[model samples]
Target chain A: MQQENSVSKLKYFPVTAFSVVMGLSGLAILLYRAYHLGWLPLWAYLAAAFTALVVFAMFVFIYGLKAIWYFEEVKKEYNHKVKVNFFSAISISFLLVSVAFYGYLPFVSAGLWYAGVIAHLLLTFHTVVFWIRSEFEVHDINPAWFIPVVGNLIIPVVGVDLAPTWVNIYFFITGMFFWITLFAIVLYRLVFHKQLAEKFIPTMFIFIAPPAVIFISYFRMFLNVDVFSMSMLSLALFFLGLLVFLVKDFFRIRFYLSWWAYTFPVSALGIAMMIAYQATGFSVFKYIAVFVLVLTAAIVAAVMAFTVKNVVLGKICVMED
Target chain B: MKNVTVVVVYIFGLITGILATGFLINISAETVLLKEMASPYDFEKTVEVLAKRINSTKNWHVTAVIDQAAEVKGHGEGDIGKLKIVQYCSGKYAYEVLADDNRKKISVMMPKTFSVYEKNDGRVYIAVMNGSFVGKIFKGETYEILEKVSLEVEALLNFINFKFSLF
Candidate 1:
């Protein structure tokens, strides 16, 4: 009876599986960024991008059909904010891949990039309008709503030089404002409302992302360091410190693909520090950048290896058996 | 009397803030474009001569000569005049920049590109990204190397301009 129960518990096509893109692409860009910063050799960027592409391809092939199933499953629960926003992970993954390859293949990268842009526009519009149109409880709010918003900020990293100036500004303004609005809502939920569901606790790490990403995007947009850039960096550091204090709480949650949620925000902060070091030439920031890079890289590597092992063992995709 | 003084101070502060911001914006807007002179030579001859001159330069190797005009024409767009980007990289500088973490970011702007294009007026122009100003934003060994590279870039453009002047 216990064996049957275990088999029944398997999640062959969890929507959360798309989140592997977050780690794989995040690390790829991290390596590429490292290559740009001279932390890694030239071949390192190529190798990292190749690895991300392979993993992305495998994900598409392995979960392609099941993804449809996952979509249907989630669509049934579409009223849930978490399920609805999880769809944004797919779009965000495409954005990350586009950024990883952008330096190498501009034309092809642009194609994937615009796909992400359109996806974010459509998904965010639908999700936000649904929120405003519906009569929802305050407890429904969570950091995952920030996922859809984060994509706008991330667009400028790839789009600033590649796209038209107006387009770049559009994404920056949209992302910046939404982030502020969502930050207030998510913060209010955290303080006034009850503790989030266990699955959601890992996503608290996402709070680190807005400032981290804004730092990068703002630097790129202005090509100069100023009060705004410094403020973003400070906020990112503050969030990083906060996450560290909650490290024990992070470990208490059951491991799921949602754990991938923790990778990109820290990765963004790592890349942000590198940008700050470049802009200010501060050694301390460089050290912090390297430290964050190493820690995030290691975390991503461990999580990915464990995930692959679990997948192979039929412990993940297979029904509870 | 106190309220009147406070109102005057607030007005003065707002005007000063606006003027300062306007001054900053004006300074930021002053970007130097890398455009060189109009060549009497047509697109084909200019690109050919430019490619030869570039390859002749020490440590500079032309990696690719992209025929962007052919590409746009391939898209069924009616003929736009010849536009080509000649990509070249200095193996020496590549090593220098790639040697350290801070310098690696330079690769984003790497494989130095020169766009050679002709206008509707039949004038051919050569231009590059403003390297010097971009380099100044970073500090460290990367900044030193980038500054050096920017100077080298300026020298190359001047040399090309001088060559065209002789024609």
Candidate 2:
């Protein structure tokens, strides 16, 4: 009976936690830079904290590697169209590390960039191949698909100066086109197909990522202000405004690794705001940057704390529906 | 046959005109923004030379040297050639700038960063951000300090380039 009860209590950790670990770690590194720039003196501690989370993320990645026995469930989740896109969050985390450390620790950042670039490309290419080779119901389409696509947009962030201009342009164009294609499909699904599953609802915030990420990418790659960059910023702000009302339901959901779905998009928005401030020298953008930095930092920290608590209480890393 | 020959000449002329225009625009833009140096030394040697100069200077120290190529390899992949960022800061200048409440915000742009990279053609280049142009964004003492720092930083890079060029 004791052994049976132990087995019963074991909850299977979802692969989605890969994203949570990455998202929070990425956010922490962003905050460290923000604090450093703002002269807040919290940069050092945050850097240490981020490193710790990176170590933990490595372990989680290993666990995911061994979870191949769960292939049946993985395939089911993968074919679901929306759910599989969350896998891209793991890619985002590595890319985030690359950007954060690009200045302070070049070698580490470069390594992470290479890792992020290869992983994101494979993930994205395979996803596209899947889309071409398989058929999915129209209703299954949602914003989560944007996750895999955003990886391309993210390359230009650090890769702008590091990679050749042509390579960066390739990623920028790929990301831009796919973002448009998915935006149309996702909008149609929202209006006509069906409401998204409750667990996947928070991913609505993902719509905010492409514009924000692309804006940052364009500015970094070209190192100049242009019409396209301005448009990206404008669209990003508009979508972010729309998400304000949409995310009301997100806060009501219970804590799950899916909560990490909210982290990177917000962090990207914050980074975009900073880039805008850098370009325009506007005080308003500066204030907005600080606001986003604090808000995402709080969200990531709270989620991380809760995650640890759940793990200790045997709520994570076991089997559950 | 006569008409086809004329059309081909016109097409070639149009392409030549476009290329000439592009070349002129690139030259003008280069003059307007950025003070760059071409290094005969490889990317790593170029960074090492500059880092040594900064270290030897008074009131300035090399805080960090970021080897971007090594970083990519650390992630279980091959290196990305030679891209690096060398960060340096003057303690005296930083203290002077941050001592005031008004100028504290510019601290975010601190540590005076410059990038060294080898492009696809295998030519090495060092690019420095114009601190003075950035300083123009601010007003008062902070702006003055940024302007001063910008010139000093520019001079440092040029000095490094000159010193390396000699060797």
Candidate 3:
């Protein structure tokens, strides 16, 4: 009876839990890029990558159990207004893990890339259709909405090698179009509507991911630092700056699962800065890259600590109101 | 009013000085610390010739030939044309640099690199750190050794007829 009661808690496992994998995988990719820049040792990258893989496996196992035991709960989350957006985190996690491992295991990376691309595309289609069919208040809009769009942008990062150029371009264009459309809507909502609830505040960082990921994908495809790529990078930096300016608000918020939202976007920006430094050979970008990478590492460490604390306190994996 | 004018001028002058100094450092750092030259051979042949030359030299051995383009592609960063970094080291030079405990930090520059890459244009080029210039920065025994190393490395690339320029 005790074991069965404990196991029943699986029903409370939120789909947003997948964001933890996205955060860890993003940090893994950032560390990998830092290794190439000669700023960090190879072991650092390997450690982060290994940890991400382990965490990803754990999440998949637990979530799989949740899906099996509580299919109706999973369906409820799927139909949820904001929770539905995080399902794409599952796909983004796969793509990021594929990128994190691309340097060491090309074959395995290719398989993961294919799986990630296909799954993300299906999620994007589902999310978009659901958006069109459903009615949502302006207050329902949040930065999490960018999750599916950003996943599209990530396709070309690893997809540049796994798929044809046209296929990469297809995802890139779709991501870019939706990112802009959502940005306008999200911004309007933020300015005109009430502030986001404390639980969702950390997701303001997602504003940084789309442009940063777009910059990396664009640079990977063209291998040049032209106006368009620079613009994307600058926009990412601007969002990062805006978040830093609002650091007081972020500091006051209590820990929530959405805190994982702060991790990947910052890591994506760090990777983008490293790529900018590589493409342009500018020391300024190198300095910014180091700064952002250190910040990303710190953020991931803090979130992990908080997550562990919450799990031990029995605050996590509990039913939500 | 006169004091305020003076303060404004001082602030403006400081800003201008900082900007000018930054511009100068940026330009000088690139030119003073590196050398670039066009390679008569194609991209693959250029790396092959450079590796062979380094191997043939006395007391020098090619440590590694890193296919940077392949590495970048595998990392999925993007294609950077055909770029190869030919890393070579000399046991004698390594000993000389490391002989002094104080100068051990210079080992970071060891296993010296020669980057041979194809640009957007249909030409192959070789770029390496200007050892002579770097040696001059740490004048004395280190200078003499690095200057010799620089000359010897330049001699290894004699097959390339083009004049080396700090681009």
lDDT of every model, 2 decimals: 0.73, 0.70, 0.83
Off by over 4 Å in 1: A1-12, A61-64, A67-71, A77-79, A313-315, A318-321, B1-127, B130-167
lDDT per residue for candidate 2 within A192-256, as digits (tens), equals 87788777787787887899889888866655446777778778888878878776777777776
lDDT (Cα, tens digit) per residue for candidate 1, span A1-321: 867544333325555676788767777777766766657765766777777777777666554444333545445445565667777777788788888876455444555666688788787787788778878788988898888889888988866654556877898888889999989988998999999988789888899888888988876665545677778889999998998998998878766677888888988988889877765567999999899989988888877877777767666654311
**Taking the tens digit of each residue's C-alpha lDDT, what string does model 1 give over B1-167?**
25576578768956875665455334433322242455546788878877887688787789999998899999988787789999988898899888887667678888998888999877888767756445646655675576567645644553332322211
User: lDDT value for candidate 3?
Assistant: 0.83
Residue A99 of model 3, lDDT score: 90
What TM-score would each prediction reach against the true structure?
0.66, 0.64, 0.69
What is the full ranking by lDDT, best candidate first?
Answer: 3, 1, 2
lDDT of 2 at A205: 78
Docking class of 1: incorrect
- On the 0 to 100 scale, the lDDT of residue B74 in model 1 is 93
**Highest TM-score among the candidates is held by which one?**
3
Give per-residue lDDT, candidate 3, residue A274.
Answer: 89
Error of 1 at B58 (Å): 16
Candidate 1 vs candidate 3, TM-score winner: 3
What digit string (tens of lDDT, one per residue) describes model 3 on residues A142-222? 999999999999998866654567988999999999999999999999999999999999999999999999989986665
